[model samples]
Target chain A: MNHAWNVTRMHLRYNSIWLYMPLIVLFSSFFINLIIAVLSDVPIYTGGVASVYLFMLITGLLTLRNTFSFAIGFSFRRKDYFFGTFLMVAFVSFSTTVLLALLSYVENNLTNAWGNELYFFHLPYLNDGNVVIQACVIFSLMFHLYYLGFSISSVHRRFGRYGMMILLIVSLVAGSLISAIITYFHWWQIIFTKVIAYSAFQLSWGIGLLTIFFILVSYFMLRRATS
Target chain B: MGQILEINGLTKAYKDVTSIYQMSFTLKENKIYGLLGRNGAGKTTLMHMITAQLFPTCGDVKVFGEEPYENTRVLQQICFIKESQAYPEYFQISDVFATAKSIYPNWNDGLANQLTQDFQLPLNRRIKELSRGMLSSVGIVVGLASRAPLTIFDEPYLGLDAVARGIFYDRLIEDYAEYPRTVILSTHLIDEVSQLLEHVLIIERGELLFYEDAESLRSRIYSVSGSSEVVETYMKGKEVIHVEKIGSLVTVTLLGKKEENNKKQAESLGLEYVPISLQKFVVDLTTKSREKVVKGQ
Candidate 1:
């Protein structure tokens, strides 16, 4: 196959960098908390809002689906297209993950020396290092698959505006339905439906399953797009 | 002369609306051929089919004796410059050059860079951010520098100012002279490229109207100008393709041999026989053919 890496490289240089905004905002929020601890003589390990930072991680990845789809040759082989996008996302994620870890490490040490009991969550402790890593990996892939597939299906057609509107409506409806289903269904007897709704494990599973389903659905829709 | 491109009964229809119908034409190597038609006359459609960007609904298109669709050997030897070439929002002018250099094996980077400077295209500016004229310049530069055996320019000079367009035409002719190849220029700017065209292909409403040498086309239709009454009387029992009336002056485009009798009759009636510009002749021919179709329908 005639690979156009130069073209792909330019695409990532400009668009892929935007995908890291969530990590940037997350690190900035942490840095702010660290600064406050420094001024108040409090420890850096003290907990802050986990939900805001996690939400940033999820939405940032989701929003990037459009840019990734646009940049990569999604019209070509689906495997290669998805692989290219996954590689870029993985690279960005790894870089940001390392950066955040270092920042947290320095803050934790500073606060510990000051004798303030500050609590910092390392990525490895997000819930069994392997589990969180698996969750993040699966979550990123699934989220990307679903968003890319849905957008490619609906964008650029005679009823493109209507298609996009319908896609948005369907995605929102699907997301709510999943949330509602999880709200009703208990998992493993130990975790209640509401508890699963609040837990990161369920979030990772939901995203992974949804992404796999989306990939299958998108391949079908792509026949129409490419036809 | 060896046949560089052969399009056999090429038919392209979208949803039963035929854009090109059973069109067959062969382009000889080292000749500049003009693909002429009014807008929606299927000129661009034929070009697209030839370039393998659009597959023909029926018939075949061959470049260098092979199918062009996904046949890299054929495609590599062909450069298709669309009127508005779409690029990603992030792709800079230099990115286009970089991609073209790889895509077209015959791509001359030195020439491409030179054209960039001549066209005054900012190498770092994204393609989407460029002005319409600049975008066209970038396309022209690629089309020319690619130096493909089968080069096609489908109205590639749109939105370019007259001076810049002149530069393009001059550079194209100069380069083409130094290195001859099969060049198919599809444009509404017929008069501008008339001198450069060795042959002409006229399409009228999805059908190939005429395909002949440009010299023969000029000889095929001769304009007879005189008083309306006298010219109309002389034009009887003759094939008059187009008739233009300006006040009392009647210019009848006669499509037959310029016999001595017809000339004498025109001379006796104080008429003048003027050579029709290739552009005007082609416009009249296609327009007249279209009028006949409309009248028949």
Candidate 2:
């Protein structure tokens, strides 16, 4: 357990990737949206904020490739690496989500989208309900996307390229099969109606459960991964 | 001294190939061992198993008398610097040093800094930007400075020039003298590292061929050259690994530590005893075994 912190510290050494780039990408996207919204006559309700969330998912995948093989061969137990990476990702997810939540509050309540009426952060369904629930929505979504990428990369690491290729084919086949079944039954209307009716707080709980599932899977896959 | 490592009947097999097969050996504490073998002789596979980076398909490895797979007590004490050591794309040499300081319990920053200067490594350069030799220098620095109980270097100086390699050897000998610990160096450059090696382990075709002190291994074989008839007579009933003939002169490389009668017999027959080098001995040993395989097939 004590050595696990060492592993976490090691991962944190790449601050440029984990901390600086994400912030840079987020703010860059915001400025671009802000400029276009200020010039337009009508109010802007663009989804530019999704770019930052997309980058967060990429971080989860990049972290494994950049660090997993290196650390495992450096005399660190696989469990130590898993725990350390978990702590680092969890901390980053929570803090980044909180920041996003604060930005949403300011855009909605304080500055009214910086007076340009640019609706980037406080989207309709995502920013629903009270402040605490609003933060949970972003946190849960960010956590889930991050771990989803993480779990996929772990599968790649534990298994070789052939295993990863086979897994990807299987996942594509299964995904298409499920969508075909849903379309045949016209379940999209039924599913979205039930899903859209749920409050932001309830949806956060569902995404949070999926986040936990991915974290558990990544742990097991990484525990047995070799250098 | 106590046992530092023990392997019993270890084997590793892939779909259609076996990297290591039924190999076994024991290493004592505080000694330098040379893991010498040809390129595909399973030297790296054996080292990977010792460091717990790869699983043994048929046997077990005990480092300090405990399994190293996820055992921090054992893992933390073993530092393996492989030929293909990977680093993060964005990591600088300084970052590697900092991380090494955190992971290795016995890490010596002073030695690390000195080696950094000795090897002339650019601390701020990204590892990916460095040349191949510079990258190898990084591995050498970390391997020496980490000072783990069991430090294994598997061809750590792949692209390093002779001068840089000399620095590595000098620093290794100096640090090892002050701090006694187990070191296993795996490389095909037997001639360069032969003098520094105390014990030797030879692997060929996924099996252990020889495990003995360096002195005995050196004297284990010698050659005799003279008239073809006299040399042929001298080689009778002896273990001859290789034989060559040029004109009327015949040379036979035999296996037996410089025995008294062996040299006396050569002298009486007007034959000369030619001392073979460690590198030549290994080449002959492995090539002989390979020829055996080819003939068998």
Candidate 3:
């Protein structure tokens, strides 16, 4: 069997949970969207569509963190692992985006007719007939997450759970302190806030860029592991 | 005998603690070698190094005169059956067989299915869902069916009942007779596999203590028992492996072959002779006097 295909088949068969993850994210968004729709007395069309990206971001974070363990956990070649993961995440993220977009279209029409109701409209992440490329982009995005997860997990296997939590707390505390100092200083508050927000945005974009670099690093670790 | 695998001062260390010392040995083709060692004696570590699952801290290992690491040509010909094989959680028995068929060039599906039926392993159940014994059966099945040139079984009888283990032994011997490949059996059950092993390698404290043919291994040491004076007289000028004294009666293990008239001489001198079983010989060889030497030097 082709090693990549074998690995991909194994992933699909054993880990259908990854494919269904988007649904979990979608549904979570749905409930949150429903709550906002009811409270604000507005149609679920726009809010629900925007929520898809939020769902993608959340799912992407989780998907990135665990990508490495599942990718190269066994005796499969490291390259095959990377490719197999790339294929699986790409298929999943793109499928979710399309489904959400179709759902949003239905939502927009329903809202116009019924004043305030939960329905779907085209999500912002969808591209016109470029599903393949879109999926690849999503895959690259998640692959970055996988690299981060694998690197951190390698340094400390226990890092995924409590280590991540501790990291989260520390980052939060640092950000809050920094934010407070900027607010008190007042001189550069506007500039500081924009820089902070841009940095966060850049951080998200940087994940995809760093994923390529990490893939090579991950290969090195994998080579070490096999030996 | 032509050596299929050779080790030259191989050592593997984890941080400060050394798991395997600068050990060296040669494994010949088409022979069954017993790797006899107690727990924490570096048996698994040595096997892992040979199979390229680990890197040696120093020294070298050659399989078929080539390095085994990531060399698919060499790897495809070797099978290392871990004591407790780990399978993907959702992979069924069939998946493992299929994966083995794909990875190993010589994998025989027919042999795999046969072993699966003989072991009564279910094909549909996920690996994780199977019982411990069933998991062990799966490992054995893969090891056998792969039909690799150099097959290493490391404590493969862990969760198997005695009957299943007996079946494994019988099948192994039967298959081995027909196939004639190199087999390395690493197990604690010395008595059970004593007959199957043609050669034995006894290790102690990460060091190779003895490596010799099993048939002649017994001739290297002989036990003599009689009155303390008689036994001591018989053992004079000979290498004495062990000596036990019970009142006037004494038993002495001497390192030498018994002559045709040696038994008659013992009888004439009021001494008794007993043949040492392979298990007793290995136990005495691996354990006795080695700990003190290791501690001191």
Candidate 4:
């Protein structure tokens, strides 16, 4: 009877189209690649799963813009709304992660890339870890990207168009400034060395922390947002 | 009936404009309140403050005797439907109703179904694809069927035709009588909804002008017109609320004791009595306040 759960239901009802689309796109691309791999007799390595992660990001960006106002009109508490959105996205990420893990297993061992050497689901570095670790890495990556989008969306919700504009300009300036400084100081070598030293499992723990940060920041901003 | 809502010294100020000035009012349970005001008079701002959607610059708002902001216990018992209520872009009318059904604990599926038919809405159609009037009907259906203990509708019938508006009023009254609740309706069609309102709250330029029973509001004002000189003479030592002059033919509304003999006295003095309606009174009041603001500036 918690209205937070009701908010999750509300989101789930409208999310069907966006929900299944990434999977559909992934599978379609997989089959098409399978056809090409069979004909050419060449090893096919692809980033087809990238579409699934990017789609989650888009869903996060749309979450508040589409539903927050409507839910508030229906008398939902802000906290409940955020809680529901959180639950819904978490459910989506977990499902996506599980499916990717299963497909990766099939490509690696079960069918040997569907008998045609098509490495669509199993990327080398990403799947280097054990099955549990690989699933964790994928889940962390998808969940983190979704929350990153949600956090950005919440800024607009709380602060309006000007807020988004200011954020964009600031991000661009900061990104350029950081890139310039890093190049001038020749820091890329050190950064790359440290980054490459960490295993994918280790990297996912960092992503897990960043995902929590995005979730918290989004909730704080959306708390004061109006319809 | 207990007090369903109580607001004290509420105000919302933006960087340059004050949306609602210091305002205070207590609303009793199970009465339909008419939140009457001209456009930009802060009626919507006040309602948003009451529902805890918009934070006030300063004041207290208690719904069901508790602070409403972020309070689930208080929020779940309230339903707020507005003219520009948003829906998910991909939603159909049926999808909207399904979400509403899940959100509202007191939701009436039978009434929702009946209203969907009464409004002649194609539930399968995407909400964005519906006509403006159909969208209004969707809000009306949800507001009526929610049956929340405290329901607020801010201009709930925009773009609706006369027949559809009549159906709204009829359904509102019928549903309200069957299941009594505190309803606050803000609208510009004052005359149409005058009879439905038990109490009237008039806001002028972010300030509370009138907060009283409907009958008292009607009985407290009467209008008369004559030449500028005679009307001025009659207005001496009298509390006047509104006046209009057309080439020295003067009309003035007096705010004083309601009396049967006042009309007779006006006629005897060669002044024409203009029957004042609730709508006229509200319009005259807001116009007069606008003049006051203009003069002050």
| Candidate 4 collision pairs | none
- Candidate 4 stretches with Cα past 4 Å from truth are none
Model 3 misplacement above 4 A: A21-40, A43-140, A157-205, B257-268, B290-297
- The estimated TM-scores of all candidates read 0.75, 0.97, 0.79, 0.97
Docking class of 4: high
- Please report how far candidate 3 places residue B56 from its true position, in Å: 0.7
Using TM-score as the measure, name the better of candidate 3 and candidate 4.
4
TM-score of predicted chain A against the true chain A, for each candidate: 0.53, 0.94, 0.52, 0.96
Q: What is the lDDT ranking, best to worst?
A: 4, 2, 3, 1
- Deviation of model 4 at B5, angstroms: 0.6
Lowest lDDT block of 10, candidate 1 chain A: A68-77
Q: What is the DockQ of each candidate?
A: 0.15, 0.84, 0.24, 0.81
lDDT of 3 by residue, A1-227 (tens): 26667666666664555566546656777777667767786545544444444544454344423433333322345456546655665666556656644444444444542345655343333322344444444444544654565554443333336655776788799999988887898847678666566533344466667866665654565555532
Worst 10 residues of 3 chain B by lDDT: B254-263
Give Cα distance to truth, residue A34, candidate 2, Å: 1.2
Clashes of each: 4, 0, 8, 0
Q: Write the per-residue lDDT of candidate 1 for residues B47-104, one digit (tens) a residue.
A: 7777665668899998899986656577668888887456656678887676667667
Residue lDDT tens for model 2, A34-146:
99988987898888788767977998888889988899889888899889888888788788888888999999999988899899989998898877888888888888888
lDDT of 4 by residue, B102-133 (tens): 87789999999999899999999998899899
Give the better candidate number (3 or 4) by DockQ.
4
**By the DockQ metric, which is better: model 1 or model 3?**
3
